[model samples]
Target chain A: MRSQSRIAFYLLLTPLVLWLGLLIVIPHIDMLLISLRERISFGVYDRSLLQYEKALTEPLYLRTFARTAVMSILATAITLIIAFPVAYYIAKMAKGRLQQVLFLLCLIPFYVSELVRTFGWMILLRETGIVSNLLQWTGLADQPVELLYTDATMMVGLVYTSMLFMVVPLVTTLESLDDSVIEAGYDLGGNGFSVLREIIIPHAMPGIVSGCIVVFMLSLGNYLTPTMLGGKDSLWFTEMIYNQFIVRSNWELGAAFGFMLLVLSSVIVWGMLALTGRTLKETMG
Target chain B: MIPTIPTSRAFRLTYGAYVALFFLYLALPLTVVAVFAFNDSQFPSLPWDGFTWAWFFGTERPQIGVFHERGILRAVGTSAFVAGCVAVLSVAVGTTNAFLFNRYEFRGKGLLYVLMLLPLVIPGIVLGISILIFSSTLANGIWDLAQMDIQALRPGLLLVILGQFSFITTIATLVISARLQKFDRTLEEAALNLGADRLTAVRTITLPFLAPAMVGAVVVAFLMSFENFNTTLMLVGSDAPLTIAMFDRLKEGSTPLLNAVSLLLMLGSSLLALLVILFQRRP
Candidate 1:
């Protein structure tokens, strides 16, 4: 029996080992190596730190990185604000079929491609789009307003895209809480707001932390939303990395940028783990 | 039950209104896309010229009406194939891992579990670009050793599948693992005690229990792979997937056909989900 268990364990470990080695470890090693290398003309990578040095000193790349950080922070804040109430409602208020349906509604967006969703935003926010046209007719604006191609529009897209991620884990954690605990708090003379503040929020801390980590990471790494919505002038960090690699053919600089973003994400994940006193396995799995 | 204050009718109405407004916000984009699918205008937006099926069925030559575009159809086919392959492969690997992890205790177990999950937290752009670079480098080395003529290893179907599978498999494993945790270990123990071998006990007792979760994981995995854009954008070869194709067209400008495609995709996925739910609820 012990031998059989050992065999089973080894079998389970094999796929994970193979996946990590091939996908994560190897790719990262290659990226690191390339980051140390030089780039030839026409986007071909040659063997030097010239690109990294240049990227580090360049004001454009620095500015873009700072802008991405600010945008990601703001988007994360907005997503949390919108998602918390809905998650609270679903977790504490809704039950049975209604809960299932509401949860499914949150997930349905996952089925649609991001491209399509963003396009929908484009149609809604364009000069002759619904929002703009409505604003014009209502005399909110003299003419159709230009709402597209701005940071605000980009934030709208990011928050909308990532809200589900925040809501799901929050719901799951909140659902696991004992309703009687809240009832007890009320029985002991706590008001609704006080119960929520002292009991519910603390209990759901892990979920909130996990949700924030996810939203932040996704927002930081997101390139497409910022590019499509913010238009040509948008200098998102991911876009900068993309330009370095694809447009300028500077792999080392791109690698440096990629590494920076990676380290930042890892730090955030680590901070969340420390704060919540739980491992990634616990939160994610 | 503790006595609670009854919510007023006005409060209930306000809450209902809020919920309705939220749903409207969520559904508005989808509704617009679906409605514009029937629009006669070339553009997807308002001021409907007339109602027509010309976009759906018109074949004017290279371009086709709007719906008959060969590129869109080909991209859709490619996406389906790739997503299908990813789903099957991920489910197979994920289920096996789940069984192994759940059924037995062994050395390096925690480390292996962490390794499985690393892909989930990693950024998609980094994953995509790294995979592209690694694959090309490896392909170059293999070609040199074998002396085979293979040019440009970066963009292709294989890379896209690899890129997608890396993350999708994590999702599958996580889902299956959750299901496995709730499974009764006593059933397997009884089977083993009753003169059944490990494989047979697993085949009869465990596999049947895990089948639904495995199926659900496959569906979710397939959908994720199908809708994938960031990684696909980075790793896809010259040939575009449906998402990338739509993105390209949108970049040029909005067209009603893109909305048509979105509506079709939305309807198709919802129908599939409905079927799966019905099937699951049948027994």
Candidate 2:
């Protein structure tokens, strides 16, 4: 019986091992090796750090990398700020029916594709779009305002896209907080701000950290929102990676840029985890 | 619900307004997308044009409906096929992963578990390009060394499904494992002790218990695979999925037919979500 159970275990283990190893692990290692090489001639390569050097030195790539990191961080922060109160209202304020309805409403937009959502934003923000038309009708502008392609527009789209992720985690964590804890703070002469700062924030830290990590990763890696909304001047890092791989056919440089993105994003995540004193298991589980 | 602190009328009104504004923000863009699908004008944007069913049902030129657009319809079919294949593969493997993690105590389990979650943080674009490079290089190496051609390794629908599968399986495993963790081991043990063999016990007792989670995982996986853009964009070859098709069209500037497709996608996915919620409510 023990032997049989062991056999079953190994059988179950095989698929996971293959799935993770062949698909995730081996491919990444292959990418790393590819990133470490430079093309000396047609179909001939030499081991070098030229790709990394280019990524670090090229003004376009460097600025784009920094810009992407900063924008993603900003987007994460904005998403948290926007999501917190809504999550709070859902978790603590709303009654059962209202809570369910609101939660479902929160989930409705996410059911659609990101492309659709981004397109929706385009429809609302374009020069001939709804918001621009409303602005002109309201005399807010002299002529139709083109809002489709700007950093601010991109930021709004990113925040809109990532808010639900932040809200879900925040709601999960906030819902678990015992109400009496907050009541205790209030009863102990704590004002709303004090109660939130001292009790609620601490309780929601895990959710906040996890949500930030997810939102940041998503915003950093996002290709669509920035590209479509920000247009030609978007300067998104993923676009650079895309351009390298597809347009320039520089897989080696693309691999290096991709690796740098992986490493840097991981570092930021690790830093957040460390800063908040949370482990992966704690937040994820 | 009880308030943590006493709130003034002004504070209460302010909070209420904020909540209303939040929902409006969430709903407005989607509402615009759905509403504009019926717009009589050439564009998906405004001037409050008269409503028409042209984007969905019109067979006329210059206002071709989504159903009449062969490219969009074919792309939708392609997306559905890829999503279906990905859902099955992800859930099947994800179920195994859940069982592996929940049932066995093995060395390096923690490390393996962490590695499984690594895909969650990795950029989808990176996942796409890495797999592209790895597979193409392997295909090229095989061709050079053995003088044989392997088509599956190249960029295509198969690769797109594989690319989406890489991260999606992780999600499926997470969902299934959450359900499995709450399962009562004694039920399976009782079956084993009552003369049922292991396979029979799992099939009858354990499988039924996991059925809901597996089903939920399927819908989640299917939606994720369907909605996936970043990873699919890199891995897709000649055949474009719906997202890719929409993206290409949008780049060239499109009409309300795109909006029509968006509305349809929204309706389809909302129905799926409603079904999952209803399914989960069943005892």
- What is the lDDT of every predicted structure here? 0.81, 0.93
**DockQ for the candidates, in order:** 0.55, 0.77
The docking category that best describes candidate 2 is medium
Which 10-residue window of candidate 2 chain B scores lowest in summed lDDT? Answer: B1-10
lDDT score of residue B59 within candidate 1: 77
lDDT of 2 at B109: 98
Candidate 1: what's its TM-score on chain B? 0.90
lDDT of 2 by residue, B143-239 (tens): 9999989999999999999999999999999999999999999999999899999999999998899999999999999999999999999999999
lDDT of 1 at A13: 71
